[model samples]
Target: MYKKLFLSCIFSLLAICPILANGELDSCESEVKRLCQNQTESIKKTLACLKKNHKSLSIQCRKEIERGVKQEVQTKPPTGMLFSGGGGLGGRFSFIPLIKYQGENFGPLGSDDEDKKTRLRRQSVEGSTPIGKIGGGFISTSVRYGVTRFKEDQFLNNGTKVNDKLEQLELGINFNRPLENKKNINIRAQYGYRGDRIGGSDYNYSLMTGYSHPTESGRGRWQYFLMFSNNGPLGSNIPIPGVMYFYRTSTMNLLLGLPVLSFQWTPENTLFSLSLSTFGPFYNLEVNYGLVDQVQYFIFSRWKQENFFLSERRFEEDRLNLYEKVSGVGMRSALMKSSVGLELRAGYSSDRKLYLGDGLFNNDRGSLDLSDTLFLKLMLTKAFR
Candidate 1:
């Protein structure tokens, strides 16, 4: 099975590089002992003497050290279940390597209709781990693999074949527990697979269970859930019900329920930062800036969708869908002091699509419309913070 899912994503990236966690300086412990108390010989020399005395600290320890150095150079290490994907809460371990391209276009179903340019490429890898205290709750797992390619020939008006190549794999797990009215209860699950060679391959799953509570004057909390997925979109594949409300302090974090909505903010000795999200099937917006403290620069926009299941179907309840919208600009660095990182992005993609559906009730047998393009990405990372 693809070499056991590539050796289970390299054994969850070598088991989460020894339990990563070196980036939560206890909310700036008293401004790091009132400013690098002897630089404690580590934690990167107390974060380089608190960014060299970041204007002497205080305002809640300089907004938690500028929101942890802008999420240590713009975060990106998720493959589901970091608090059920809605603004992750804590836990670490990562390994990323990606490459993407989108060039060549000429959509609106080219070939003979003219403009037959078609192109797309992708390569991916992801990992995650942290499976500690089991029964008492606290476990994690993740794995992913992607391989996409679509070039040349693009047919589909019943002639099927819309440029082949597609292979995906995923696995996830999550769990949390804590009660006694202190609130917390979680459970998550995921499984996915999709191979392809013109139309064949399937396996899917998703689930969630939540409970959060808190809020008796603790900044925020209150989440509830029950979800299901079979790659959604047709009566949303059953089990559904949700609620949310997260809100944290010291530099913000917010989330508002049903069909989730998330937000993030960072100020106080800032150099810009912002975020937005509508979890699950993705919808994002980001902005960041802080060209130092390990570099960062970003601006993003996204909307995504994916669904696949096609055991050779020429129509009758077919499925294979993909849609995307993009906008981008990116830069992230942090290799010099190493946790190993790098990122870059370029964009412009619009109302893309590829189809054959049954999840929105019998979608026509073929559809392809992908043009307005120009995409690029490159990433390399090894993180645990």
Candidate 2:
């Protein structure tokens, strides 16, 4: 009975083997057809089922599907709308716009005398070019139009009230080139023309040369600048004090000096600048009268983060071995984010010989000079980039 039972079991197993093998072959063929149709959902479901039941089939199918998907993604093209290029003559262009209005009053601290009062009002528009590399060096141009009206009750301390109004316009060209020494040094130059309207019309020309050095560690930078300027008068009634005595016009004057020792510090966001300037005496159309030597020094410090700055200025005039000095200090602060600011300045002046025409007052005792001035200013600026 045991031998008969064993034979029946072997015959049943042999019949089931062919059926199981045919079932697996049909499933694999269906999976291949679905894959060719790019039906990733059906492929994934089939792969999961195969992995649970057969390890070898799962590995082969997953690898093939992954490779196909990767190739498809790699060859696909991007899809988006197209746009026109910007209209720029010299490549990409950007603009910065600036507008400012200022008002100031200068006089003694507690004096209400209009005779010792002066008021100035100015308005201007300024713009600069975007930074770019071109033409062997960087190039840019700037232009501005400004109107200044000044009223001095006591013009020359002689009690001669003078009301002067001036309208000015200027245009400048700037160029820069890197030095060959590799010391991170650059040389720059600028040429400009200025037109002024003082009672009549006048024109002037100016040129400036400078060197700039950037810090190696990127902490600070410095620049040194020298400038020369020439002025030509239009009307014959204009006053050229040192050049033509009292009121002589059509004189040509030359001024030469260095105007900058600018330093920028990064970690502190502070800028310290010193300007030393001298003006050579005026020369007539034919010859020079007497050389009027003048020296001016300006020191300014600005803290960007705090939006505050302090400036001090000293001006000295020497002629025929006699000298006079004027000194002042100014401070500025930003009051709001909307380009509003406040300014306060104080000035002092001294004349050695008490020149009658100098900007000072005198009494019977001696020369009445301003020990200091407490003045205030307010301004509004619109800045854009």
Candidate 3:
């Protein structure tokens, strides 16, 4: 169990760059200078211009640009995993509105009191920015904050009412730079600090340092990386080592290794695709169909877990953890010239468990099994280059 938790922590530590096959953008330099003379300030703008005029471009330019776009879509990280990347071309911000969870009573297990219905609400916001460039790479800073609130309708068997609210905040910075002379070899580093409860002793720091090597293959590229980081959960204080490999083609991208396995595929010029990823104790599966270049519908299922340090002790333990399995369908669309995005999701949350103890496997303090419920979420996002 400790090994499993350690791998989950390693997932956050590994710094993998989804560098598409090189030469695609460089090969179109002349075309950009000719067709997009006014939008040469940034790669994002140049790519947009190329896409807008795809039908009129030279055959080679059009083909390469199309391949680049498909690879970008296939490897782009999900909003929730924004801070996981070592570096990014542009930055993004995401916010999830406050949502409630309700269905049955939420008290201690094997308790006869059915009147202790609890009101639970949750919300979160996160963003990242590139501060500067170093060795032809970008250095990025990221922040994430979230809050969960709980209120009980009546007093439980114990004298105190159940109010195990939690707040989590994390700040991070990361960078990826190539070796002095060998551009094929890259060095990556990241540092993060998480404060489980503001002004409490539940804070921890994480550090990761690694290097990656990319080799050219037929119609694709292969990247391999190795890293070392601090452990994932409490009571473990050793640095762990991990390794991962990534392969990308014009239509498919795959990352295979311990603690992380991701696969994404899209047919050339098609509207449907599928993505599946698992890291540590977390996993997400998605099937998407596009209506237009900027809008899509999807079905997804995922497992999410959160751990915290409580300010006040309800039992003998000072730690609390929650895990939930969710399945849902949603729609997302890019608007405002593809700089803004909105998503609406409705789903069922089941197999929810909340426990307290020193760690995940050692939950001897108390545990609660929550009843299944339906949930809805509205997320808003903005991108800046």
- Predicted model with the maximum lDDT: 1
Model 1 superposed RMSD (Cα) = 17.6
Candidate 2 overall Cα lDDT vs. reference? 0.27
Q: Which stretches of candidate 2 lie over 4 Å from their true place?
A: 1-97, 107-125, 131-133, 152-162, 178-201, 212-226, 231-373
lDDT of 3 by residue, 119-186 (tens): 35667676655566666654556666666666542222333223555665666555545443223433
lDDT of 3: 0.48
Scored by TM-score, the top model is 3
lDDT of each: 0.54, 0.27, 0.48
Judging by TM-score, tell me the better candidate of 2 and 3: 3
- Looking at model 1, report the run of 10 residues with the lowest lDDT sum: 11-20
**Where does the lowest 10-residue lDDT sum fall in candidate 3?**
9-18
| Per-residue lDDT of candidate 1, residues 48-89 (tens digit) | 554355456555544444443333222221222233431122
Error of 3 at 182 (Å): 8.1
> TM-scores for all candidates?
0.32, 0.36, 0.68
What's each prediction's clash count? Answer: 0, 0, 0
- Residues 1-385, candidate 2, lDDT per residue (tens digit)? 1111111111100110001111212333445444433432342333233323332333323222222211212111110000000001110011212334455444444456543443334455544443544655455444545554444322334332223443444554445444442222222222232222222323334444545443454222344544333321111112222211111011111122221111111111212222221222211111111110111122221110000000110111100011224345554443222323333434443332222211212122222233233334444444332
